[model samples]
Target: MAKPVQLTWLTGAQAIRLHDAGLRPPRGPFAYALVCDVRDPALAALANLALTDADLADERAPSASARTHFRARRSLLRALAAAALGVSPTSVRIAYDSDGAPRVDGLPAFVSVSSRGPLAALAVASSPLGIDLEPFDASAEPVDAVLHPREQAMLAELVSTARARAFLRIWTAKEAYLKALGRGFKRDPATIAATCEAAQFSIDDGGPAPLPVATFAPTMGLGDLIVACAVTA
Candidate 1:
């Protein structure tokens, strides 16, 4: 009988098994992270595999680079999830909700994935959550577009490179929380105030209270990249 297992290879990327990550259900709680270069030559074989009918839709996305990254990252997503769930990667069905959030068909765990530059990151948990990773690119996105005026003023005081890195850190944090809330772009990013220094954020969505957000930089699998995750309190 074939036994599904977590695939770990230090040469290509950082991988964490459920057991190694100490993330077993009914055992309180734990985190699972896998960070890799989707464009790595070593991952070519996995990325080139055929896509199912459903996945093919996402593969058809415009922009050659994004298309490649999408196919590669999502394919590997199945492989990682299968390793954690002890099933064949191909058989691990992935279904997207109306909001575009992905659900690993057989598991009840919350999952999120993000990719940028040379890295792709993912996480799964027993609770609702969101994860995001982005490289520091000062010109890629404008901080004023998503950050509160007060936060932008604070960012403006930092040196050039440091400011960009800080933007990414705080931006990723905001994204992770929005993802956790399943609001995506439905909620305004500028409405949330985040402090990368504190690795936390807060926002009030007219619910008569503010959302208690638990955000952090996950150091496990990230290599030369900025990463963050958000879970409700």
Candidate 2:
């Protein structure tokens, strides 16, 4: 039987199933990443496999090596995705900043992936890419210190984090945009804010525009983790 690479969001406990579906690794210098809610052991194992068996050369140091299982799974998924898009896996390249924002090179654009647990997400773009996930924590304190005045007002007036679920929804959306742009934690989390209701971004300093909020809604809900991803059109 065949399995879909991604699953639909559902109510009740979020349980994700991960499978390689019997894929063979290809030779390449590749860049592949994924995001999953930390609760997902199956997906973690699968990711481990990708990083393990891949025939990719490390971008930071060509002489350096990756574990077999780790390269295998990540490389496999990247290969599969690239194959679907009619590109070569070996030609795929990944570069990252000190902040851990990953970018694909030698291709038309870039792609990135992040996984926490139950949720595994991928972002592909003709430009830079970013992805972020937050399980939603009301205990995390108000995010105002990092936001601009306008962003602070927006969060105060439009969003609610009293419920853990809603908090994650807003947090993930902002993080996704930051990651898509390769800013990540270097940028103020509060500076780039979103709302559960709006699911859009308000970036300080007039950075990149937010991605279409709808792109993330379809992949939401995996355990306590809520994920948001952004990419170039």
- By lDDT, the best candidate is 1
Backbone clashes in each candidate structure, one number apiece? 0, 39
Q: What is the C-alpha local distance difference test score of each model? A: 0.63, 0.46
The residue-by-residue lDDT of candidate 2 on 1-233, one tens digit each, is 11112222221212212113433222422222344433344444433433322234442322323233334435544553454235555555555557766655455546655543334455444445555555555555545565546545644554445444544555666666667667776877765555433544333335454334322443334544555655433
Model 1 misplacement above 4 A? 1-12, 16-26, 41-50, 63-65, 138-142, 198-224
Q: Report the error of model 1 at residue 47, Å.
A: 4.8
> What residue runs in model 2 are displaced by over 4 Å at the alpha carbon?
1-73, 88-91, 97-99, 117-119, 138-140, 154-166, 193-211, 214-221
Q: For residues 166-232, write the lDDT of model 1, one tens digit per residue.
A: 7777777788778877678788999877754354454444455455444444454445466666655
Name the weakest run of 10 consecutive residues (lDDT summed) in model 1.
1-10
TM-scores for every candidate against the unseen true structure? 0.72, 0.57
